[model samples]
Target: MKKFAMVSLAGVVTLGMVAGPATSLASTHEDPSTTDYSDVDTGHEEFNEGFNIYLALTNGDVILRQGDQRSEYVSDVQRLLDTRGFSTNVDGIFGPNTADSVRSYQDTYGLTVDGVVGPNTYQSLSDRHPYPNELFRYGDRGEYVMEIQRFLTEERGMEMAVDGIYGIETERNIRVYQEYSGLQVDGVVGPKTWDSIFTYVR
Candidate 1:
């Protein structure tokens, strides 16, 4: 009888060990990593962080969409699309033409063909044609300088020629705007100045 009882106890212990691993495996299958977000909206907070980081790095904070008002953010997207040979007006307006261009860009780039410029679309655009991050000083010249000229003229009420030349007038305007905006007033379009300008524009 003692031998029989010992054998039954050993069998019970073996069964418990097998059951423990099975239970652990079942729990692991229900882990949060396996959770499905398919039913959730793509615009939810969970999915916007990456795109928000992209915008913050690029000095943009708005998610552009159709029928949105004219702003510098829209102009940035339009410029990016044009740079990629998508050919849309850089008019700072999210019109139908811009939407069609965005869709075409999305289709060509193997992104979702949604007309909205969401995080994924922005990532693809940035990957292909990154925004100019070079420092712009008094002697800089190009489209970025022209952008500054336009910003000073249209947003800050400064009368300057948008001729893509960062001459004395542009530097002076930058310093004045910097002083007025309570920035460092360095007269250089560095990250801080760019952020200040984009923050005000957006």
Candidate 2:
């Protein structure tokens, strides 16, 4: 295993291990200091490899192609494709179906109809359905709320309906997740909460 260090704004450093060298570490976030890198490993080589891909995805530096290994980042790209009306399975593996979907998306968007998801294709999809940046609290409603609800349910195993409405139940679940993540136990979803959530999704 090879050790890597990620430092936070508070001057706290956490270490993780990967079975091989990381592919990329580029980022587009305005303030990298807000991101938390605590769950980057599980002491297993296979799991660490997936986590390395996840980190690159969150950093906006991943270049996925056909025949790539399984990783959550591939699943994320599949989800984005499906959201744009190109149906594809959300399986973690980047197989032929995913490549076909990427080609279709690229063709429709007037991009080079290559199956690979390099920087330009990824940026176009991101621009179309950009991640939510506004602060969220009780009574908010829309796709952003649904995004957080889905993240909480899928990633954190929180039992809640992804109805795109921030109600008491949603706030309660957010508070629970905040407390568990060692963040401020406030119900509002702000920069810190978004950073933590995107650590898994981006």
Candidate 3:
């Protein structure tokens, strides 16, 4: 529960909001104004060229800029907030709450305190563990978990019915797995469980 001070960008005075303690911040994106694509006259294709798709963050953590307004990126930011126990609306508005959460994230990760997602901030996000989507593999047994089941059946020789239902048998199997791996034998497919499951898959 560290406190963060929001400073205006009068000068480039970023205090490494995420990774504090004087860790140097890196700027991976070009100096172009990273803002909403709607304001520019450039066509979609041109904007796509400079859209920085490779800079997308999969985790609920990111370096958000002060004035960005992309729907997809806003979704990413919202996801980050949700992952970190914040229940803010994911409406891509870049409002005050998002700003405060970004400040908290910056302080947590020790990034520049600009509250603007930049390259150095993006790098910090990439290194985070327990990303939001990782939980999808457990519940619902959707496409992702189904894929995991397939890998388990083919590789681990565990005779699991691929019915996409995480019931008692699945939990039992998971407990057996955790016990075998010397993990907390709670029968849950947590991050450590997933990592151990990978060993069996290959």
Candidate 1 ranges beyond 4 A from true positions: 1-84, 89-97, 108-111, 119-136, 139-158, 180-182, 194-202
Candidate 1: give the clashing pairs.
none
Q: lDDT tens digits, residues 76-113, model 3?
A: 55655555565567888777777777777778777777
Candidates ranked by TM-score, best first?
2, 1, 3
**Candidate number achieving the greatest lDDT relative to the actual structure:** 2
TM-score of every model versus the real structure: 0.41, 0.50, 0.36
List lDDT for all candidates, in order.
Answer: 0.60, 0.63, 0.48
Model 1 shows how many backbone clashes?
A: 0
Residue 176 of model 1: what lDDT? 63
Give the per-residue lDDT of model 1 (tens digit) for 1-202: 0010011253342111221221222332333223443342222242233334446535445578899764656776786688668888888889999999999998988988989887678756755212245577765555566766765564344666787656655666676667566788666787767766644422
Pick out the ten consecutive residues of candidate 3 with the lowest summed lDDT. Answer: 23-32
lDDT of 2 by residue, 1-202 (tens): 0112333336643222233222222232222223343542212343235446555654558889998764667886787678668888888789999999999999998999989888678756544223344677766565566777875665445667897667656766676667656788777888777776545332
Which scores higher on TM-score, 1 or 2?
2
Q: How close is candidate 3 to the true structure, as a TM-score?
A: 0.36
Highest-TM-score candidate:
2
Model 1 TM: 0.41
